[model samples]
Target: MRAAIIHGPQDVRVEDVPDPAMLRPSDAVVRVEASCVCGSDLWRYRGIRPVAHPVRMGHEFVGVVEEVGAEVTRVSPGDFVIAPFAFSCGECVHCRNGVQTSCVRGGGWAGTDADGLPVDGGQGERVRVPLADGTLVAVPGAPGDALLPGLLALSDVMGTGHHAAVRGGVREGSVVAVVGDGAVGLCAILAARRLGAARVVAFSSHAPRQELARRFGADDVIAARGDEGVAALGELLGAEGADVVIEAVGTQGAMEQAVAAARPGGNVGYVGVPNGITALPVKQMFNRNVSLLGGVAPVRAYIDELLPEVLAGTLDPGPVFDLTLPLADVARAYEAMDRREAIKVMLRG
Candidate 1:
């Protein structure tokens, strides 16, 4: 088996590695069919996040179950499935409360499990999925290749975008604004509209991303940043800012702009993986009575609700993947995203 390993900044290689095997009775081995590079992964790839040693790459993937542990009854070999970025035990209190990301026994991909057994990364031929019954969602029947990207999106970005919208309190006839134009932000536009937002604004400087934003249901695209961007959003929505704002970029500037662009009593749902953010605008938020919501999205909680729409063709996030590459060319995929040459890159395994 081959998997992506990041030796250092700008140095990702796909090399032969040991094949994944179940190490626990509740685990399963999944033969990955598709995976994608996430914006969060770039933190380490760009050296912003310390890469002290070589590490496995990728956290989003959808695939077929190749083998199941003795206690795994929800799925079997040959079952198509979507693996959320985080693995959680379904029986935990947090998971029962719809916050699977914080499940007491949960963990992330590309890392060792509680027992210290190796967990293969998603950007590989196969992965050892812990908490198989709780982490893997089975898809009905055989889906066509055309649906792969959309299904893959559900593994992370799509559900994450939905989480932001939900946390922002988007509802029927609500006016919404989204900061950042990455894949997560683009999907936020779709999620807002899906939640019945009457008007959605996207802040994007790139022509291609702006076009895609409109296609995803953004009524306006403001190509500016900082105070200029907030002012533009205010101008579009009048003296009162948007009813809800979604922050998809984990930067101080983006967060500030998101808070500034929201109405005094509105909400700012942020899902970006925080990079340099040292603090929040506590005083400003206090003065404005703005509600700050959202964090690492519990995507597993939303997958069941969003998966049906994706399968029905009513919600297609597949367009977000403008570039697709073979797993062998994983490095190129990372470069394309880091260079902004691709909105998102899908890897075919």
Candidate 2:
């Protein structure tokens, strides 16, 4: 089987690897149909996050069930499925509480071992999905259909966006401000509007991303950064600040801007991958009465809730996939994203 391996920063390559086989009763082997690079993947690609020995790449994927274990029953061979980035056991307390990311019986996919070897990432041709019943959502559609991109987004980015909006307390007529204009942030804009936000302000300096943000439902775009951006948001709202602020970049500066953009008593949802050892403005938060919300995003908990909209043609997240490449070109995809030439990259297996 072919898979993607990251030897080091800026060094992603496609190479032959062992094919996956179910080694646990709860596991299933999937013949991956489609997978993609994530913004978080860039953390390691750019050396912000350390890459482990024999690093495996990719986590977001939508594929087909090729083989199932004796205990697997929720899906069977030939079923189209979307595998959320993390694997979880449905019976865990945290999972029942709608926080599957911390599921007691599950963990992340990449850089972890399976059958005494580094787990194969979704960028591979086939992947062994742990806790298959709990981690993979079966969509009623054929492979390579028009819904693939949107369904694929559900595996991570879209669900993460939905989680950000939910945590930000976006609701009918809520004034929402999203900081960052990547795929997740764009999806946040879309989710905010779907949740009934009357206005959405996106902070983006890139022309392509700003355009996508508006297309996703942002009513205003702010190109300024730091204090100037915050002041611009205040002027737009004509109040203390926006009712809800979404922090999707996970940088210290982005976090500060997000906190400053939210009105007193409002929520700041920070869903970016927690970079820069973030330290919030405690005094400002205390004085202004602002609350923070958001974490890794319980994608499994919201997958079912968000899928119907994607399948129904109401939510089109497909546009986020600005570049699509074959598995052989995984490295090129990463470079495209790194250079800001692509909003998001999808890989076909």
Candidate 3:
């Protein structure tokens, strides 16, 4: 099978890899129908994060089950499914608490499978999914290209954006602000509006994304960065900053800016993969009475809650994919996104 591999920074390739099989009783082999390049994937592509060894790439995917392990009863070979970015046992304490990302037996994608074998990346024709009953969510039917993108978003970006909004405590008439203009950020704006936010302020430096942000439900758009952005957000919300702030860029500067743009007692729901900024100003947070909420999104937990909206056509996140490419042209997909020519790149297998 052909799959995507990241040899190093800015070097993504489509190459033949060994096919995956159901190596464990909890595993399933999925024929990937669709997957997308996530903002987090750029962390390694831009060398912001190290890719020391050649490894499979991609995580978000919606596919059809091709085979299932002996113990996998939740889904069958013909079922359509969405595989979140990570695999979890679902029986762990953390999973039970709705944090499957921290499930005791869970692990991320692009590495080895549960049986210690090479796993095909989501950007491939097929993939080996461990914890099938826990990580793979079965959709009612096999959706065509039109509905696939929205369902695919449930695997990661959309779910993560929803998680950010949920953590930020968005409610009716709430003033919401989102930092970052990437796919997750735009989805955050949509999620905030869906959560009943009266107004949503989006931070976007790029013109195209700024337009998309507005389309995604952002009431205000700020093209500033750093202190200028904080000030802009502050100016919009008056004495108190936004009621809830969503930080979708995982950088120290973005984190600080997010904290600065929130009102006293405001909540910041951050779901960006933490690239740095490990230290927090406890003093500042304590004095301002701000609450920071976020982590690897429990996608499994929210899929059920969000799926209905997607199925009903009430929530269409498919527009976030500004560029679509075949799996064979995945390198170009990465390059396009790296150059900011695309808001999000979807890959068809």
Q: List per-prediction Cα lDDT, in the order shown.
A: 0.93, 0.88, 0.89
Give me the runs in candidate 1 sitting further than 4 Å from their true place. none
TM-score of 1: 0.99
Clashing pairs in 2: none
Ranking by TM-score: 1, 2, 3
List CA RMSD, all candidates. 0.7, 1.4, 1.3
lDDT, candidate 2, at 254: 89
Would you give me the overall lDDT of model 2? 0.88
Choose the strongest candidate by lDDT.
1
Q: Candidate 3 at 39: error in angstroms?
A: 1.4
Residue lDDT tens for model 3, 217-324: 998999998899988877878895798989998888888888888889999999987888887666777899889999889888889889889988999888999888
Candidate 3: clashing residue pairs, number:
0
Tens-digit lDDT track for model 2 on 289-334?
8899998988999889988899888998888999899999999999
Pick the winner on lDDT between candidates 1 and 2. Answer: 1
By summed lDDT, which 10 consecutive residues of candidate 2 come out lowest? 111-120
TM-score of each: 0.99, 0.97, 0.97
